[model samples]
Target: MKYSARLRLLAVQTGLIASLGLGFATLAYSETILTVALAANPQMQTAAKLIGNFEKKYPDIKVRFQTLPENQLRPAVLKDVATKSGQYDVVMIGAYEVPLWAQKGWIVDLSQYAKADTAWNEGDLLRPIRNLVSYKGNLFATPFYGSSSFMFYRKDLFAKAGLTMPETPTWNQVAQFAAKLDDKKAGVSGICLRGVPGWGQNLASLTTVINTFGGRWFDQKWQPALSEPESKAAINFYVNLIRQHGQPDAAKDGWQECLQLFSQGHAAMWYDDTVFAGPVLDQAGPGVKDNVGFAMAPVKATKASGWLWAWGLSIPTTSKNRDAAWKLISWLTSQEYIKLAGEKAGWGQVPPGSRTSTYQIPEYKKAVASFGDLTLQSINSADPLRPTIEPVPYSGVQYVDIPEFEQIGDFTSQQISGAISGQVTVDEAINASQKKMTDIMQDAGYIK
Candidate 1:
């Protein structure tokens, strides 16, 4: 062969080697992005920590989170799931939607994945939260955090007012305390409660009040009971309490609004989800962290009146990347992730009320010593199966398990909000709610 021909062949081989090397580099760096829709709350901050660690571990998989307020998050995620739009790979849902969505085939059943992975330790989940996220013995979602309602008040204010909060306060006692502590001249409302009109907003807290007042949404035969004496009394009590002592524009206030009020020293007392305690204590602002005190949710006829809830992660059936989504879900809810989050965000910010292991962690226990036991007690004591004073058909502390209850509860909340705003009398609100509930139940074939 000629010298020039040999040189040409060598150059061609070198070019081919360079092209192959570039191809392999592209393959190694290829990325798969997962979109997660989350509620804008403190839990999301913990999730962000987990996601950061997850990305480091799985470099090829990127995560993007869309955080929306609770009310908006529900409709946005539900619309995507119902329409099979595949817009979100993972969605944050509550106990209320898990069973219904699983039954309707809108979300993936996580039982198989959970069972197959011994390291996942499904048994570590608290029973009530575990059962709430399961349908027909199959898990549909994994709880990121579980919660129950409790009364949070300012120790400083109570001391200044010469008041002492009981471990388990009654509604009457709460009213008395509120009256004494109400000092509007100093820019503080006596109490703050959610009044936003949504099933999961105002009604979540209000339903517990109804239950403690010996009110049931329906009778044993699934009859509408909204206008019954107990229900009416509960509604009237809630309206009057908020109207007289709650924050200004109380009817428009929900969890976030009331949280701000209490944290900013504008409200002396608040009754809502226990999850808020972490943010209230940890936030970098003029929050009443050191002076905050917690007690069981106020009761009337019942011994324990707290409502149980969990914010969980579910993969919609429309997800094109179920396996990757499941991987992210597993990582976020795993004991390992909890530890990682604790390390990164501090034990106080570690997602609580989900795993038994979290409560067992010495650091977490020490960090949340003030509210840990109380929160766990509240969660364990909540009897969703027998939420109200009287026996009812459904099983949920703050919500009825049936799908129709969402619509019914939302409608009732609107009426109650109207009453709070003085747009309608309490009697008129209760009567309208009762009529609407009757129509809904009858149309759903629950009533004769």
Candidate 2:
């Protein structure tokens, strides 16, 4: 039934009065609650500890932490983001998400927040970090832990084989050493690489390998390059190397498994993210702490094709409490928190790659010993846009930046994994990957 004008006016007045009362109740009863989405990595541990300090400073605010495996975190966060469910005030992001999601307006821009807030020293962050966490020149996120890929081996194994890791090694040398160190009879596999399928999981490592072998994912005109000589050679090399000397459960190996293999002294070498240094150096977590060795990722035509990734903190546009979220984010990612983490934990636990200052710290310098210099050098040496000796159309070293990349990467990885498992030939894997990629590219309108 339609209301008379007089009745509508009464209804409006009543509703206005009720809404005002509800708003007052909301203001009175709302506890400053912030939920954060975290990744399963060392830097996340540091961030969690810093949250304690932030809580102490602002007791009224209650912060909740949600940590997921690295592979699951991004997808979960993105789902919430796309739906505007507002489950997360802060979501940990990577280099891949910073620009793409920000462009889509899913995350808040922090340029004004940084500039207006005198307490936060945005300029104090390392330049690489500043750029990595930005989208279209606006700050989109905060770096939790930054990383580049490197080779971590067992020193004892190398010594037993009469071999030593070089500051900068080559793929040929690495393969030879991997062969010599392979002792399946002793339960020690030669090399443990991330092989289980995901964009940032195995494909990230493999992309660098392909790049160093002079591969480009696309031509300037956006043609798929998976079937090219560079990618084919790189895929064949990676598949064969892992199949012959990598972990027995190579099909199941991701970053965590590979790290476990190396940290447990079951693998001779683990080529993965530099952030892994923190856990590997932890004596409590694994048995082979003292026996571990570090080196830059092995090269071919390129001196540095190692991947660059930063697990960062970003506020979503859907958040109702922007100021409260920023307060927590600022404190957790501040310089003091970084220092505190180093002191409370170990110097090795400090977040690396994000700050040049970390390298300058005496404690970290002493702790990392051989690895610090190589890690820093690798981080500095990498130029993601031009990762290989040849130029590529992509902006990422280990990834292509299109919206379709995650699906494409996971699918390509499964195909390549079939080759590694002897279910398909390398040539067959490449052909399948090429066809899938082309179809995706065409559907996404990347190519005609």
What is the lDDT of every predicted structure here? 0.90, 0.83
For all predicted structures, in order, the TM-scores are: 0.94, 0.91
Report clash pairs, candidate 2: none
Looking at candidate 2, the ten consecutive residues that score lowest on lDDT are 281-290
Give candidate 1's TM-score: 0.94
Per-residue lDDT tens digits of candidate 1, residues 103-141?
899999999999988898998999988988889988999
lDDT of 2 by residue, 1-448 (tens): 3568879999999999999999999888678999999987876866676677778888778899998997889789999999999999999888888899999999999888888876677876777667878987889987777778899888877887899899778988989998999998889898998878788887898999999999877877788887788878998899999998888968678988887777777888889998888778774234478788888988998867678877788999999989998888777777777788888877877878776666777888898886887777777777876777666667888888777888888898898777777888989988888899889889889897
Which regions of candidate 1 deviate over 4 angstroms? 1-25, 284-287
Model 2's lDDT to the true fold? Answer: 0.83
